[model samples]
Target: MGAQEDAGFSTRQVHVGASTATASPRATPIYLTAGFTFSDLDESAAHFATGSGFGYSRTGNPTVHAVEERIASLEGGDQAILVSSGQAAVTVALLGLAGAGDHLVVSEHIYEGTRGLLLDNLARLGIETTFVDTSDLDAWRDAITPRTKALFAETLSNARNDVLDVAAVSAIGAERGIPLVVDSTFTTPYLLRPLEHGAAVVVHSASKFLAGQGAVLGGVIIDDGRFDAAASGHLFPHLAHSDRLGGPSYAEKYGRRARGQYLRESVAPRFGPSPSPLNAFLIGQGVETLSLRMERQSANALAVARWLEARPEVERVDYVGLPSHPHHALGRRYLTRGSGSVFTVTLRGGLDAARHVVQSVRLITHMTHLGDVRSLILHPQSTSHSGRTVAERELAGVFPGTVRLSIGIEDVDDLVADLDQALDSVASVATGGRRTDAGTRGSEREVVVL
Candidate 1:
């Protein structure tokens, strides 16, 4: 324990944040208690004064801290804070930076849930936002004002596969003394590390790819500790100014650790976004196989995108792995390992065709989530993007025909076969064609398939 070990990712992921089990179990034990006990009055007083240990589960817990350390180690960050959901992670991360009257320059092509959170929920709190095209660095620069606290974006846009040039965008934020907060939900650390490229903070919807099995809900915020906290301390009086009793400011006490501490000690706990210890355990189990699942999923996605691009029923394939995609080159530059597996396919037949394909996919699940062991599909315009205006939907690549696909680790050929039959169903219905046994196919998961 005297020296840090530079272990490879696969090794580190499985071994990091290992708790000392009472009976030597190989897996991390879940410390599911709502609160911890101290041996004596001095011990409790010491804990409160130093903030070095756990007391209440709402503020901290050993189980959750283990998972946070693992994610931070994987993300190459100083520390991480776990929250209840991806939306909670984004909310806490932004609220830690901006408050009433503060501004944020955000990407237009983000998850509709996140968009609504910013434009609607946060607006009620007096925070303002200016959405700009993520790829256009000039617009990113033009949107920054004196009160702008952060440049928020996703590494690979949600639903669509538009790649954000992180290095270029971070440079602009650096010039304006603002941190770049990236939602890496689409491209987890296995596919990309936003901090190494230039982002100051990275966030994820751990419920999706991190859990990898769709069994739990969790989120994380990883801080690289490289943002200029000293310069921005003036803007954040909580970290810059002294307490009422005239103690040193958080910046003076924690320095580079202050931003993450603010989120941990103040924002997240006050907002009550604490994750369950059981969910943290599930996310940790999922992280152990993250690299393996991501590799298989990315390869499967590329194969499916190619297949879709060659089909007459397809209008456009919005996967970055395809050469035809506008961001293919930028995707290559950033996502050299693999372009993420979540993408969209626009059908030539519009809404009806979308409905047919979504309903007919026997293998892929019809759900709203991405990043699972099983492939999933959704019709965006009528589902995730339904609340957006026509212009807003168009900006996010959500046409009546656009369908989002999250490729999984299923056999690529089987996935293709499912899509082929579904697309064929669309063509058949269009030409007044009928096929026998259309409604009788069976699945093992048919507990109630009506």
Candidate 2:
């Protein structure tokens, strides 16, 4: 089917990019072959020269293509490319647009892995990045320079639950002729489409909610085709200088699929980070129920956030759905139906209490990953954001007692009760007469969880 045919988000999720309308096995088949055979010599040359159709599993595969197309359609983009992992997607997408001597403007509250990639790895490669508060349009404006090639931010940042103003960022990108790239891993396309809000590119770590069950690790980069790479040719030489290498210019050959093509040909192939067909099939299977899982997960998250808010042991809750959150208004403006399934909560007792609650949980798995069908919890200060210094952690809104929760599809009451028991356990440990700084305070400590 054509891209236009896949209109609605749910419709695209259910029916887009299927190779067979009805498989005998009743699922998207996984083509596990390493390479495809061309019909003849002329065909082989044409395929290689043009880079059209599935040439090899490493370069392109049917199963991967199906997943990529479905993701592109879901995000309302011209095309997409699926990679082996979320980091690969982020790396290739950024490297495709910006390179040595270039700079990128990004949100300060991005995933820690991404932060490391941009700050440590990319800096070593001569690419510099400036982190800005995503909510502040002025910060974004000031951060942009003549060498800025792209603007990047998460729709909803991890752990911190900060909601970015996509329109504001997009407008800034447009003014500077830079493409706006947003990581929609947290919100997912079922909840928010960044392209619709003026974003030029949308990305996702399908390892999370898009895969729904945490069974596969994959990533996707979707190009909206709205930005004119040719116009900003100097800033993005890769798109402008394809002719020098006798390869199709990204804008000329792929058009709206330029970014995807760039990632596929130059970035992904060189990095050798292609997703396995089996993983693609699994991720595709997960996509079929994305809407359903997200609905239940969102509801469960809101309930858990409210439950945590009412408890005296909790100092703060960071779910955007809660009115107490600083970003609640922004969440309402950008996140319509639901805030999201992932959030953070801070305990009154500090780091020791946070560790106690994490160890005390019975049902929620104390793991670092989020967006699973089963609820998961992690201490960001000690885990995800541990690489950052204390000052850096505090600036990113990560407190020593902060505990992040990824609400799953479990019953709401059961989740709440589990949290209640965990909080009670923290209180017990704090009041058991260990009057330490990490355990108790002069006044009743309020634990805030977001």
Candidate 3:
């Protein structure tokens, strides 16, 4: 028998989407072929006509479908679509909801790549975005106009570590009948579920936490099945429009599943952002131990944050796990498991100090990626946020002296030692070596040496 409905998250991650092949394989078997064979002409016609069976890998693969189901189950969503990359998933989700002349109200504290997607790529497409300070609910409300289709934000924002008030934002969208799309990449379903707080869709960079080992790249869009595209004809007129065959509209055809089916049937396929079956298999394998990895990674991150706080070279530690962080209370309310691991550190010594610490880290690999089994670091101003202006960068909490850390499931003591060495390596112009503040290194950072 399959897992029970009330099974734990850890149990579900390991078992919810296991293969049902007659051979009874314990793992999800990767269906690596480009296409599936049809038994007869009628079968092929029926498959295309009704969209019932697997036709090609681009549209559907058993391996990809299995992982999709697993993620949907974990996120408390009705359905999910796995895509080529995180950008592709965000593109598909946004494109499905908006088109030419449409607009989106987004959180200012988002990934830089996405900031470019809205301000650059989507702008060319004639769609616009209004960015608001995520903590200001009034800004979110005032930004919405007649063209606004969705309110988008990260559950726990990238780099800055400010926790989103999902309930507050989603309530604003709810009042306006606009669906809320949340990027839960920073806080995976293991730590938070956006749907539970009234978000209509949850997006993830499966390459991060979902594929914990960093061996594969993938993304997923999970729908709560609550947003009725047909209800708002002014915005989603396409859903209400009839087909060439004069058939019932998508809302009439799929009932509550209209939004999900539209993305799966209309948007995802036409855009061609499908995930490779091999990648899907790898993501599924990584997901099996997601809860375990997240638990350890979160714990390790808190220790590192505490350690960073006491450094003379540090200006501030943005990890919400720490009480000193601005969003600690918000994180406490929402991220009950642990405050997220991916956060930024601002150096008092400025850009020179950032360069020194980043170059000196031996254990923490200097990379652009996050949520790996091994710790990683990045200078956002030079890498991810380099395209933006000084003002834009500062708005998103990207500063010249700041470096983002994606904490991994490593020994807390070892991670602390590595940071201590790296931060201590940052030389002050006055001292000509590690900046030694008299009171800064108090009580060895107060973190438990796990």
Question: Which digits, one per residue and each the tens of the lDDT, describe model 1 over residues 234-260?
Answer: 667777788668998778778888888
Residues 1-450 of candidate 3 have per-residue lDDT tens digits of 344568988887776765555787899999998998898999999989778889998889999999999999999999999999998889889998999999999999888788889989999999999999999999999999999999999988766788899999999988877889999999999999999999999999999999988888899999988756545655786666676689887877877787888899989999999899999999999999999999999998888889889877788888899999888898999999988689899887656677778888889999889999999998887788777667766667766677899999888888888888877656543333433333122222111110
lDDT of 1: 0.86
TM-score of 2: 0.89
Give the Cα error of residue 214 in candidate 2, in Å.
Answer: 1.5
lDDT of 2: 0.83
State which candidate, 1 or 3, has the greater lDDT. Answer: 1
Better of 1 and 2 by lDDT: 1
Expressed as tens digits, the lDDT of each residue in 27-104 for candidate 2 is 677999899877788888988888777779998898888888888888898888898888888998898888888999
Clashing residue pairs, candidate 3?
none
By TM-score, who's the top model here?
Answer: 1
The CA lDDT of each predicted structure is: 0.86, 0.83, 0.85
RMSD of each: 9.6, 8.9, 9.7
Clash totals for all candidate models = 0, 19, 0
